[model samples]
Target: MTKGSVRSANGRPHSTTGGRPPGRPAHADPSTTGGQMTTGTTATTPTGPAPLRRPQWVRVLLVMLRALLVQSLWFWVWVLVPAAVAIVLLDRFGDLDMSVVQFARYGGIWYPFALSFIGVGIQFTVHVANGLTRRSYIRAVLVTTLLIGLAYAVLMTAAMVVERAVYTANGWAPYTSGHSASLVAGAGSLFAATALAFTAGGVSGLLVGIAFYRGGALRGFLALPLTVSPAVVVMLLTDDVAAGRDWTFPATVSTVPLTAALCLALIAAAATAFHLLARSAPVSKGLATS
Candidate 1:
């Protein structure tokens, strides 16, 4: 009937307001189009900054431990594979006088000793630069040192046991190069000696690491006896329960338990000394000023 108007179905013309009610605005919300609320839009709840989380030393220790293990994978591969081959070849052809397992013992010690230096020399600066506290890094390293030493001890002991079996099967003697006659008499004794020695090496590494880090080359050199004494003493003690070759302590007093206790005490002392040195050690200007 009229422009912009539509007729109802009953044959009567009803005006249309362009499909919108006359009183409603053109840009009115669609939710109120029919006097009813629609679920057409979503509301976002405001969020605050993520809650601060304290740094976890356990996590740091695990991460550092894994990194150390991965980094040393090549070392173990090189050492174990070649050493195994050499043992077989030497036994097959050469008249070997001593056990080849002894090499692994010394290697187990020296490798951890060397690794300790890197743990502090590089990791300390890296941790500091990354906003980690020195105390946290030190604690992680200390725990990692113990764990790695134990791991090496288990590996070395297992190798020794396997070697002993092979030697026995071939009618060869698995004679250790240590001064103590009973060092390799039993698997338990062998493991104890290995664990004690390796742990001592790790702790000694920390001592020397902090020493060199805190002091320059000259000072570190000067402090060698003090810093390195723990490892040396433990190694010597493990080698020979007696200070004198002619004089030996009574078997009851020179038990592995006593030896372990003494070695643990020495390791604790070295670790304590390292903590003291590291606490006061200044961060190198080249690494991290703060």
Candidate 2:
């Protein structure tokens, strides 16, 4: 019989004077549990979000290519329409001494100026599409412009070759000096020259983009000078060269090297200006006016 059950008629089990069962864990105080003690050891802290990455070159390239393709299409239409009209007018009148080749050459010389306008359009479109930094956009523009200029030079040279062949086959002598060799060399030179010009222009456009991002409508006025300065210098030098005059110091520079040097200088100046402009704050007053 149990010790407590010997004298008690009730059937309940007796307490063992404050002794607990074997292997049972101790109980925590209810007051301590209320005061902020936790059972788990590890605490979970939240982390901040990661930064957004810069865009890839492929994305930038695609944006640039699309702008170029569209601009080129429009450019072609612009060239063709005027040419067709001119051809019709000439045919209606007496046949002139000028061949289609001559007309094409004249048109091609003016085409670079036309491409400047296209460059502006490309700048605007690229800004809208990529939201790229001014520098990145400028790089993309320069690359695209170089590619377009190269392609144009190649096509123009090929056309000249075909024209020469046709003229020869028709018993007309090609009158140009160093016609075949010049065609090849001139194509290379023109491509280089155009690339330099485009790079200069792109640098100028980058300045404009920065100005626009900061100064808005007033930036347009600033942009005109930046974009036109290279052309102005080039035109002046070319005019002097044509007149057989040497305007620069040292007085003995070759036309090609002088022109290339001037272009490179303009590109450098424009790039420097762009760098300075990009670092400055955007002009809120100008934006407000716009």
Candidate 3:
């Protein structure tokens, strides 16, 4: 209890310096066991989520798919619904040369195409931050693009069919525009043409988005032909103007099967190119953080 002496657990006098305990080395670590040197080793738990398992990746894909599908829903509500209404109104007032709904075909291509750009440019960082891998995000985007395209095709083909029926009921001739004037040969041909064109748009948008995202301005500019070619091919093979222009291959591939095959080939190629580019593309710190 006096200077240089402290009461031990047994009430005996224990020697001390600055109230240090007896029989303890001055430099000894409290963390170590008796007479054992401490290395400060610890079992490290990962800071974020666990390494992404197969099931986790699948869940992530589903979540992303759901979000994208919701976006598509809004697009259809805002664009397709109003377009359909306008077409019916306009057709009632006067005689029209072509199916007004046919013009909505371009909407099918451009809307999803623009959305594909946003999927990569804006959504990738968010996806990663949410503890998902880029691979999973890319897969989700790809699947969503295809699904959106198919949905557009179904809706557009149905609209055209309805418009044709209305035209017939009114004792009028129905014609197609943007696509081949002869495109509405059958429901099968119409669906295939719309599906291929819409899907091509989605894939072309992906190609453009990845090019700009991964390669910066110069490279993206240089890659424009490659990035934009899918949409161009679809337009050339399917558009009425292109058909009117007398393109050589356009004439040959104007049939339903050839058009479908060509469009599918373009979509496949563009999607693959996007995947390859995006897998190794650098994430910009400023952009990601911003």
TM-score to native of every candidate shown? 0.74, 0.52, 0.71
What is the Cα-based lDDT of residue 212 in candidate 3?
87
List, residue by residue over 1-290, the lDDT tens digit for candidate 1.
77978767877666676575455445546656676544435455668887777566777898888888876677667777887788888878996555565576677777889889767888777777787777887788899988888887777667766766676577664443333322334666666667778888988998888888888788988998988888887776665422112112225645656667788899999999998888777778787764
Q: lDDT for every model?
A: 0.72, 0.50, 0.71
Tens-place lDDT per residue, model 3, 199-229, is: 8898889889888888888998899888988
Q: What RMSD does each model have against the real structure? A: 8.1, 11.7, 9.3
Over the full model, what C-alpha lDDT does candidate 2 score relative to the true structure? 0.50
Local lDDT at 185 for model 2? 33
- Model 3 misplacement above 4 A: 1-54, 175-183, 240-254
Report the C-alpha lDDT of model 2 over 69-183, residue by residue, as the tens digit. 7766676567656755664566568552233443343344345455544454445444544445555655555566556655554554455455556554554433233332223
Question: Can you rank all candidates by TM-score, best first?
Answer: 1, 3, 2
Q: What is the lDDT, from 0 to 100, of the residue 31 in candidate 3?
A: 57
Task: Point out where model 2 deviates above 4 Å.
Answer: 1-55, 77-95, 98-135, 167-186, 194-213, 235-253, 279-290
On a 0 to 100 scale, what is the lDDT of residue 62 in model 2? 72
- Give me the runs in candidate 1 sitting further than 4 Å from their true place: 1-55, 175-184, 240-254
Which residue pairs clash in candidate 2? Answer: 214-283
Candidate 1, residue 3: lDDT: 93
